[model samples]
Target chain A: MSFLELRGITRDWDGQGGVRDISLSLQRGDFLSILGPSGCGKSTLLRLIAGLEQPQHGTVVIDGRDVTALPPAQRNLSMVFQSYALFPHLNVAENVMFGLKVRRVAARERDRRLSDALKMTGLDGLERRKPAELSGGQRQRVALARAAVAEKPLCLMDEPLSNLDAKLRHSVRRDIRALARNLGLTVVYVTHDQGEAMSLSDTVALMNKGQVEQVGPPSTLYNQPATIFAAQFIGEPPMALVEGPLLGLREGLTVGLRPELIQLSPPEQAHLTARVLDCEFLGSETLVSLDHPAGQGLAVVLPGHASQVPGDSVGVILPEQDRRIFDTHSGRIEKASQQNPAALNRQNTAPRDGQTAPEATEPSFDLNRTTS
Target chain B: MAGPRAIQGPAMTDPLKLERRRRAIHGWLLLSPALAMLTVFALYPSVATFWTSLWSRGTRRNPSEFIGLENYRALLEDPTFWKVVWNNLLYAGVTIPASIAIALIMALWANSRIPARSFIRTAYFTPTVLPMIAAGNLWLFFYTPSFGILNKIGALFGAPSVNWLGQPDTALWAICIVTIWKEAGFFMVFYLAALQTIPPDLKEAAEIEGASRWTYLRRIVLPLLMPTTLFIFVNAMINSVKLIDHLFILTKGGPSDSSKLILYYIWENAFAYFDRPAAAAMTIFVLIVLGLLAAFQFLVLERRTHYQ
Candidate 1:
């Protein structure tokens, strides 16, 4: 059995959308992130697992025991809320020791655990100050210390770093990940930022409307998205999805390609020609927006500065193997061999100078092109 | 060069200085009416009261004479004055904490997801809207000895009939109960507002931290409502002295001055017995007590509670 399992959980309060029939299993020490937009039921799923909100229909089995009817206090899980939710009346030390005092832990042990937690979160010296006296980052650390001192096996965090500035967010994100790893605690983190989900979690569950669209390791979800929504929601600048023959594909099909896969080349060596509409010069890379005759718009990412301006006509080349084809009607992936007849015919009639023909007899056409 | 610049600086500032003086005069002119009203109504009466307390009452045959500290000495020596002081102190001691505690309970219940929440809230606050004398008359029927509802209920339980407001031992307590009922609802509105301001997430956090409901209330909810508690406490204390309207309708400070609060005693001395000097002395004493209480709350108690 998995260490923690949620079996067919469904909670709908207003006949509106809530988490519906969701099930997940986590191993010991695994970090899972439920990532989605606001009002997408990501936080509701976390609350159900924390036992703050009881699922109308489901069993939450933790460590081989069903705790479906248990209250939050009886579930033995610690949560770090989005608002920090530190007690304003209590100082730093008292806030950290609150859970232990509630459980009636020995004073000596409480002191030891509180000191360790404070030290780990780098809140050692400021134990006497109230939450109002601390900076935003310091208050966030105190919230983390409060949860950490509980020493529970499972920790749930609901966008704990969403209130911090960009620089402070980065540092606190690292601390949370480190704390989870070092303590060997199973953590279910919720975030709307895809970057935080992708970098910090071992497995990312991308939720849409009330269901999980995809659940896998971060790389698998990014490189081999199962649906059109997954592909568009995963990356920075998102994947460039073009319909009808942009990549020499058939009609009634959409081809998904990452921006970094398309390159600007000479017209003679390119498969499609397009005009650059805009270029955003990010510090590390330039994202160039291209307009094609067949599709709405396509984005191409190049490393460092690319000397391309608006209205500049450029040839676009897809590195044959880096394309993902999906059915337009169902939004499901169509295997390269069965779906792309034009590419197949091109492979048999004439092989390009530098490109090899795709293997015709390969049994299952892989959707992702693993570059490295 | 410095002499010419210095001489020209004042010359250039003349118009600005004149403008500032004109604005100041305009501001004071606008404020003169309000200042005059305050001096006539509040400041002047308070000073005249203090001055009157220093003189002895004048009879028709003799003119009023200054008797510095004699009224103060008479107040100290009077046994009835001491009894009334003790009664007011006891009234404050019993009503302040009891009203606050009951108000907090009412607030918690009204704020919870109980059925008929709005109805319960309105019922709890009904006494606050009713005039104190009206409420006092309403309770007077309930405490009317043989024919009263309380005695009727006591008869059903095989208990002997007892006088609720007639006896010295129960009169003050009976009045205390009435004061608590009347003021608890008024104070409940403040507690309810404070309780509503507490974030729901804090309660959820406490629950996830394994705190029981009682523990959460004691350790988190009550501590967070400290500022509201202090505010309500001051209001309740002032009401205990000021709100003697019920005494006129219910007990009349009767049965030998058992339940006479300070304000009622001051009214009797000034209007009933025609003793203005004694009434003025008592009024000054009440003012000193109120001032000290305000200072104690702001300076001492406020420092102990966290606000925000």
Candidate 2:
């Protein structure tokens, strides 16, 4: 059985809905990243699981028992906020001991756990320092240490690394993932950063609007996005969306292709002819923005030294079997296939991802990206 | 523009000459009105008061003759002057702390998420805006011996209707209560401003750490509001010393004159007894005492700042 389960969880207020019937379960040692855009209700879902929020209609089950009506204090779950939410007045040691103190744990055990948590988070030497005296990375570590010392089985972090600089974010992201893994902790981590979710999560629940678009391993979601929203939301530079007639479906459909799968080569019989609109050269990969005047704009990632110019016309080899198609009207996944026939074929591909299709549009993305 | 620039290149470049010209015109513009007001209201009267303090109390037309330090010596000997000074000190000592405590409580309650908080804040602060004389008059309804509501309520409790304002024992207390009622709310506004400046994030963090409201207030909120508290303390102290406007209506230094403050005594000597030299001497003494109070407050506050 899953360690944590949310059943029929519907939270809404004042004619507006938050997470609509969010039913998901987590395994014991699994790190599930809930990826979504800003208002996709990922944080709300986390809050519901943390018992900080009560669902208007649903049950939250933890370790086989219903904890739906439990208050945050009784839930025994630990949460780390994006702001870190460190107690500014308390030094590192006191902050780490807060939960144990509240729970009335033995003083000696409290001290032991606080020291252990601090050592685990690399914050042992800085136990005497207040939150304001520490750098952003150190403050986050203190928050992590505080949560760790709570010694809860379930750990929920809401965009914890969103505040750190790029270099620090990457390094700390790995440390946190490793720490959670080593503890064999059931972690429900929320982030809009696809990179963070991809690198850290055992299973990524791609959400849009207020429902999960797809829940699978990172590679599965990347290779076979259950919905067009998931395909657009969970990748670097995003998947190139092109509006075209489906050859097999014999209808107007929106075509999607991953930038990694699009190859930069001269025109062949099977290739799509497009002109290079722009090119961004990172150290290892070059993102070439290809303009298909007949189709939609596409981005193709090639080798760093591809030597492509803006005006140069190039042929993109979008493998037929690798291409994804969605209904233009519904924005739902019509087909996840390598071969999408030309506009003269079938009308639409059925929505098939082995799980339920997203109810409405569950939106999620990195908050820092939008807020920045 | 070209022609003017060509003519004034070397001329405009001389900053010293330009500065002198600007200062000559601007100096008069800035100082003229202030200098005029000071000469008429402050400077001339101060000189006259200094001269008068060295003389006897006499007619303004004849002017008092020199009696240097005699008025000062008389002030030193007068038992009533010493009593008034003591009363002033006692009034300040009692009122300052009481008003500050009440203000702090009011500010905390007003800042919290209590029911009818807006109404409670307005009701508490309403007395502050009322004219002190009017407030004093309103309190008279309760201070009256027999017909007052306080006595009527006391009678219900099986206590006799006792004279309140007419007695030396209770008159100071009566006056102090009225003063606190009027001043507590005014001080609370300062505290409210201070409380608002303590960041909200700190409170939220404390709450997440499982700190109850009390713990959060004691450890985080109170420490952060120290600077604000100090600021309000100094202002409240100054107000307590200077504010005796309500006394004239409420107590008027009644019965054995136990409620008499220094300012009222100064009023009695200056206007009622027509002793201008004595009044001037008393005024100088009052200024000295106020200066010392300000100095002591600053010294205490400076040390507090260093420790914090």
Candidate 3:
């Protein structure tokens, strides 16, 4: 048995919005990120595991114990809330030591843990300041320090960085990662930001509309997105999709092309011509946004500042071998042969996964390659 | 307009000096209205009352004269005045804490996700909306001798029909109960507002840290409510001496003035007894005590409560 397991979990309000039939497991030290857009039930799944929200039907097993009916405190886990939720009245030291005092831990042990957690979060000197007196980053650190001092094995975080500015967010993310690694904590972090999920976790469970779309390592999700939603959702300037029939493929299929893979060529020697709408100069690479006759918004990633003027016609070389074809009706990736739509690729075998929970053991095929 | 620094144009004058003069004039202009109103309504009456307290009562035959603290000296020596002071103290002590406690409990109940929550909140707040005189009259019906609702209910339990308002023993306590009932609902509004300002996330965070519901209330909710508590406390304190309307309808400070509070006694000294000097003396006493107590409360509690 795994250290934590959620088997057949289903919790839906009004038959919608909440998570549905999510089954996942993690080892003692695994860091799993439930990643999706807002309202995708990612936070719902994390809350269920934290025992904050009870699954209408499922068994939650934690460390060989069936804790499905247990209260949150009894589940022996700590959570960092998005609001930081620091007690306004208590200073930093008291806030961090709240849980320890609640459990009747001795004063000496409590002091040691409190000091260590504060030092770990860089909140050492601000111990006597109330939460209102601290900066937003410092308040966020106090919340982290509270979660850490508990010394719980499993930690759940719900968009904890959403409250901080970009600069502070990265530094806090580093602190969280360091704390988790040093403590060997099994963390189930819920976030809508793909970059945060990919950069932080060992495994990423991509969710859409209350179910897991695909679950695997960051590389697998980035490359071999198992569904159209995953392909469009998981990358910066995500995969550009177009009507398959416009590209001389089957009429009812949709074709996906990675922004970095689409090559710009001379108008006479290409698959299609698209008018450049604008160009964005993003320090390391430039994204040339184009309006294709068949595709609404497609962008091509070019390395190191390729500035193109708007309204210029450019040849878009969408390589046939790199195209990911999907059944438009189902939104799941199809296994079509790499070139000339020869046949369904043998790699994407299970069609049933499109409609239900996928067996995301990790993909066997390299689904995406960054070629820019 | 006769504005400040009208003698010179801006470019012709020292800019910093002109700006400072303009700001000072603007500041005084802004303050004039509120200051004028407070002077006429609050400050003038307080000073007049103090001035009256130092003089002797006037008769048509002999005009009033300054006796200098003679009325205050009489107040200290009178038995009824002492009794009224004790009654007022008991009234404030009972009603302030009792109403505040009941308000907090009611606010917590109404703030939670319960069946017909809005209905519960409205029901709790109903007493506050009714005029104090109307509430007094309403309670008058319940405190009436044999036919009152309370005695009627007590009869079912084989109890005798007690004269709740007519007797001296239960008279003050009966008034205390009515004040608590009237004021708790009003204070609950402040408490409910405070409770809503507290994010739901705090409770979840506390629960995740293994704090029980009671623990959360003690550590999180109560401390956060301290500001509202202090505000409500000051209001409830003033109300104890302030709300004497029900006394007018129900007891009228009868049964040898047993239920007579300080405010009622002051009114009696001025109108019924025709002793304006005595009433002014008592009014000054009440004002000094309330001022000192309010100042003490702010100094002591402002340090402890967290304000946003």
Candidate 4:
């Protein structure tokens, strides 16, 4: 059984606040990253599980108990905040011992645990140093040490690496993720950084407008998005959306293609012709923006060493298997060969009395490439 | 060896340099009024007081005698002076911690998620802006022997009504209570400003670490407020020493001089007894004591500046 569960949790706040319904579960040692843009209520989900904020409805089940009504102290879960929030007055040792002290653990046991936590964070020799005396990276470790000393089965992180510089966030995030795994802890990490979500999570819950758009392994979320929002949100530089009729497909089917998946063909070897509108030379990859006269605009990422310039005519090709088709009206994926062009044209033209499908319409495609 | 030294430069001793020097002189000329007033009002009095401390009890006209350390010796021997010092000590003991505790509690309550926080803050701070004499009068009514609001309420609870400021044993305490009521709200403003600067993420971190609210306060809030606490403590001590306005209205140096502060005693020696030289000597002594206290506080601050 999963060790933690949020069952139909809906929190509705007042005054311009939105409602969020989040139902998820985590098994022991599972690491879940809640990734979203700001104001998407990812932090609210963490707070609900921690009992910092009660959901307007639904229960939080931990192990087997309904702990939704319990206070944060009773939840037996440790959290790391974005600011690290180490106690400025207490030395590193005392900070790690704070939870143990409050629980009235024996002094000897508290000291032993504190030392162990310090050693794990590589802060063993700096036990006597106050928080202000430590660097930003050191403070982050102390906060982790403080949480780790609790030995709680569950942990929560609210953008804990947001304060560190790019270089430090890179290392500290790995350290914290390793700490969670080594301790066999179940962690729910919240962040807007897609990179962090992709790198550290066993499961990633992509959120939008206070709801989970999709939940899956990183590779699955990237390769197979369930919705347009998920497809656009999960990838860097976003997915290029191209709209037009499908050439080899039936009606009510719209095709989607990834930038790198679309190949640039030679003029003589061209499968389809597209106008090269612009090109960008990134260090390792060259991004070429192509426009199809009848199809949607597309971006193609070529090797950076390519000598393609803007306004050049190019040929494009896609193997039949790489094409993705979605329902024209509902934006849901449909089988490519099962659609009817006549019925699709009627559906598209019935709304416009004067316009019939341009009889000689040609299908075009879009390509959007992301380096990572 | 150098081919030709640059031509004798007139820029180093340029006439424009003289013009700029002239402008600097004019700037001081424009500031002379405020400078003269500062010299006359601040420096002259301080120097005069130090000089007068060397003389004995002297009249405004001609009664004068040189008594080098005799006034200092007399000050050491005076039992009443020691009692006044002891009373000040007792006053400080009662008021400093009380006011600081009340201020901190009020700041925290105002800063936290408690409901009606704005209303509570306004009520607490209203007393600070009121005239001290008016506050003293209001407290006097509460401390009345009988029929006062406090005694009336006490009697309703079946407790006996007793003298609050009428007895020497309780007079200093009565004044301390009024002083705390009049001043704690003022100190609370400083603490409120400090509390707002503490990042909310820190407290959330503690909560996530499985710390209770009380533990968070003891381990996080209190330590973060240390610099502000020290600031309020030293300033409160200084204000209590100089705050004789309410003492004049409420106790008037008390039923038996039990509420006499050092400044009030100095006032009596100078104006009431017409002892100019004695007052000057006492003034110098008080300045030394206050100077020493300030220096001690500075040392403490310098040692802990890292946290700030």
Candidate 5:
């Protein structure tokens, strides 16, 4: 049995804004991130799992026991809130030991765990300082220490690093990942930042419009997005969904090409000719936005700098191996095999590999014809 | 007119010293308004009251004479002064904590996700908006021995109509109820503001830790509310001592001074019996005690409080 199971969870406060029919399971010690844009119900889903918010319909089972009606405390979980939620008046030591003391853990045992958590979170020599006295990063560490000291099997974190600066966020992200692994804690982290979620989570549940678009390993989410939303949402500069007919493919299908895969070629020898819109200097590399009839928000990432000016025609090479076909009607990826008849027009995006499982919407794309 | 300090004015070219002098002048100019007002209204009255307490009360025939410690000695010997002190101590001891606790409870209830929340908050604050004398009259109808609300409720249980305000034992308590009723609603407003400042995330954090509602309130809510509590506490202490307005409408220190407080007794000494020196002495004693209490709250209790 799964260590944690949420079956058919539906909690829509206004029939518009909350999570709808979310069902997921986690193995022991899996770092799963619920990732989505702001107002996408990612935090709401985490609250439901923590038992802070009751779902209108769901059965929350943890460790094979039903905890659907249980209170947060009885469910035996710990949560790091988005605001840190450190007790403002309590000193750091007291704040970390609060859960232990509440559960009536022995003073000696509580002290042991408190010291371990503080040391682990790198909050030594700051035990007596209150939350108000600490800096933003330190306050976040105090919150982490508080959750860690509880020693519960499951921990829920709701954007715990959103308040910190970019530098602190990266360091704290590393600390959190290490701490979770060392303590053998099953964590459900919620965040809108794709970088944090993609880097930290063993599994990513990509959500949009209060529904999970796809749930898989991070690589699967990036390399083989199941829906058009997932394909558009993941990766830096995101996957460009080109209109299929522009790529000499059938109509009513969108072609998703990873930006890095497109190579600059001479206009006559290119797959499709496009005008350059602008170039953004990104230190090591530059992102070149393209005005193509095939796609919207099409941009190619180039090494060093691409000093392409606006209105200049740039040739882009679309690789056959990297192309993904998504239907325009349902916005679902059309793989090579097991073609669902629900698709209005059935076509195969030649699946490159079974592991990746995404391809072009057209059957035949002669590489020789496009290249010449 | 040139002095030793005047030698530097034309000779000095240092811009820093000139700027420092300008700031000093500005500081004094800013302070003068408050200083002048305090001297005329507060400082002068306190010093004059202390000085006058040492003199004898003058009659039409006999000129007033400086009689140090005579008024104080009379106050110390008077049994009514001792009784009034004891009554005032009990009044403050009972009213202060009770008013604060009730106010906090009311604030929490009003702050919750109850339906008609605004209506409840407005209702709770209604008593605070009423004048003390008006509230005192309203409670007078409730405490009226024969046909009052208390007797009317007691009648349902077949209990005899016992005089609440007319009796010595119950009169002080009845008057305490009036003060608490009038004061708690006002204090609740402060508590309500403090409660709203407490983030909802803290409660959720505590809940996730397996803490029951009561435990969360005790450990988290109470400590967070300490600053507001301290402010309200000092207010409650002062109100219990000085808020004798209700005494006039309610009991008026009835049944041989059972409900009399120190301020009421001081007013009686100065205005009713025309003994200014004695009243002045009593006022000095009350001020010393209040000042010491306020100092303790600020210096000691304040050290323990966490202000955000």
Candidate 6:
């Protein structure tokens, strides 16, 4: 059995989207991230597991015990809120020791755990300072220390580092990962930033419109998205989708191509001809926006910098193996044979060495000719 | 260059100095009306009262004479004065905490998501808008010996009807209950605002920390409400002395001066007995007590309470 399990959790608000029939199971020490845009019910899912909100139809089992009807205090889980939620009245040490004090732990044990937590979160000497006196990063560390001192088997963090600057968020993200690993705690972190989820979580549950679109390792979600939304939502520039004779396919059949998969090639040696519209120089690589006959604005990520200027004519090559075909009706992936039956049937009569047929070389129907 | 430097240093500051002076004069000009009113009505009367306390009351047969400390000595020796002081102490000691506790309970109830919350909140705050004299007269019907609601309920329980306002033992207690009922709802508004200001996340945090409801209230909610409590405490203290409107309606400090507060006694000495000197002496005493309380709150309690 999984250490923690949420079976068919569902909650709905009047106008706001809430989690709908979300079921997830996690083993001990698994770092799971619920990633989605704002108001996509990621926080609601965490609150359901934390027992802060009651699910209309589901059971939450922690350690093989049903805790659905229990209050948050009985759930034996700690949460680091997005606002840090540190008590303004209490100093750092007091805030860290709050959970222990609530549990009526012995003074000596509380002190030992408080000191250890403060030291672990790098807030040792700042124990005497109040939360208002601390910087945003320091307040975040105090919140972490409070949760760490609780020493619960599970921890929930709701965008805990979103309040910090980019530099501080990077450092705190590393610290959170390290702390979760060192403590052997199962963590369910919620964030909208995909990079944080991809880098920090062992498993990413990408949610869309109150439901889990796909849940897998970050690499799997990026590479083999289960749905069109997943494919479009995961990547930075997102996958470019083309339909209607693009990739030599019939209508109602679409093909998804990652920006990095398409290459700039000579017109005689390319699949389709296009003109460069814009080039965005992003430090390491340039994202070149091209105006293709298949779609008006298709993008390609080129390694290093692209010297292409606007309105420059170029040829675009989409390799056969890199093409992901989907059915436009259901927005689901389809086999190559199912997507383009004619192409598959023609391949049988063509050479077995995977060479392009001579008949396919001619631009039979000009893509740009029909458009402009 | 030297000549220009000598000329420019004062010249640079000249307009700025003139501007500051103009602003200060403008500020004082705007403030003169309020200052004049305060001097005439408050400061001058206070000094004149102190001056009046040194003279003995004069009748039509004799001229008023300076008695120096005799009025104060007489005040100290009066057993009624001592009783009034003790009664006021009991009134404050009982009303302050009882009203605060009730106000907090009202605030919590009003803030919760209980059914009929708006109606309940309106009912709780209804007493605050009523005039104190009206409330006093209303409670007077409830304290009547035989037919009052309280005694009628007592009779329903097979208990004998007791005179609530006519007896010395129960009179002060009755007044205290009235004061608590009158003040709790007024103070509830403050507590409600303070409670609303406390983030809901803190309650959730406490719950996840495994704190019981009582522990959450005592530790998190109460500590965070200390500043509000301190503010209400000062107001309640002042009201304890000044709130004698009820005594006039119910019992009128009767039954051998049982429910007589310090302010009521001062009013009686000044108006009923025509003893201005004794009244001035008592007013000065009240001022000293209030001043001490204010100092205690600012110096001791304010430091302990967290503002934000």
For model 6, residues A1-372, the per-residue Cα lDDT tens digits are: 798999999999874689889999999999999998888899999999999999989999998999999998888899999998888999999898888987889999999998888888998799899999999999999999999988999999999989999999999999999999999999999999988998999999998879887899999888777666666777888777655355567665666788889887776666665667889999899999876544523688988877897877677777677777766666667776665545521211121123434433334433222211
Maximum-DockQ candidate: 3
True contacts kept of 1: 0.89
Tell me the TM-score for chain B of model 6.
Answer: 0.92
- Candidate 1 achieves a global lDDT of 0.85
Per-prediction TM-score, please?
Answer: 0.90, 0.80, 0.91, 0.85, 0.91, 0.89
lDDT of 1 by residue, A63-150 (tens): 7878899888877789999999999999999999998999999999999999999999999899999999999999999999998999
Question: In model 2, which regions exceed 4 Å deviation?
Answer: A89-130, A182-184, A244-248, A293-297, A335-372, B1-77, B114-117, B152-159, B198-201, B274-308
The lDDT, on a scale of 0 to 1, for candidate 6 is: 0.85
Listed models, DockQ each: 0.72, 0.23, 0.79, 0.54, 0.74, 0.66
Per-model i-RMS? 0.7, 3.9, 0.8, 2.1, 0.8, 0.8
Model 4 lDDT at residue A12: 64
In model 2, the Cα lDDT at residue B143 comes to 81
User: How is the predicted docking of candidate 2 categorized under the CAPRI scheme?
Assistant: acceptable
How would the candidate models be sorted by TM-score, starting from the highest?
3, 5, 1, 6, 4, 2
- Candidate 2 similarity to native, TM-score: 0.80
Off by over 4 Å in 6: A13-16, A266-278, A290-297, A305-308, A311-314, A339-372, B1-13, B26-37, B58-67
On TM-score, who's better, 1 or 4? 1
Candidate 3 interface RMSD (Å): 0.8
Please report how far candidate 2 places residue A296 from its true position, in Å: 4.7
Ranked candidates (DockQ, high to low)? 3, 5, 1, 6, 4, 2
C-alpha lDDT of all candidate models, in order: 0.85, 0.76, 0.85, 0.77, 0.86, 0.85
Cα lDDT of model 1 by residue, B1-308, tens digit: 12223333354457765565566667777888999999999999999999999999999998789999899999889898889999999999999999999999999999999999999999999999998778999999899898899999999998888898998889999999999998899899999999999999999999998899999999999999999999999898888889678899888886799999899999999999989999999999999999999999999999998898
List the pairs of residues colliding in candidate 4. A79-B208, A250-A339, A251-A339, A251-A340, A259-A368
Shift in Å, residue B253, candidate 1: 1.0
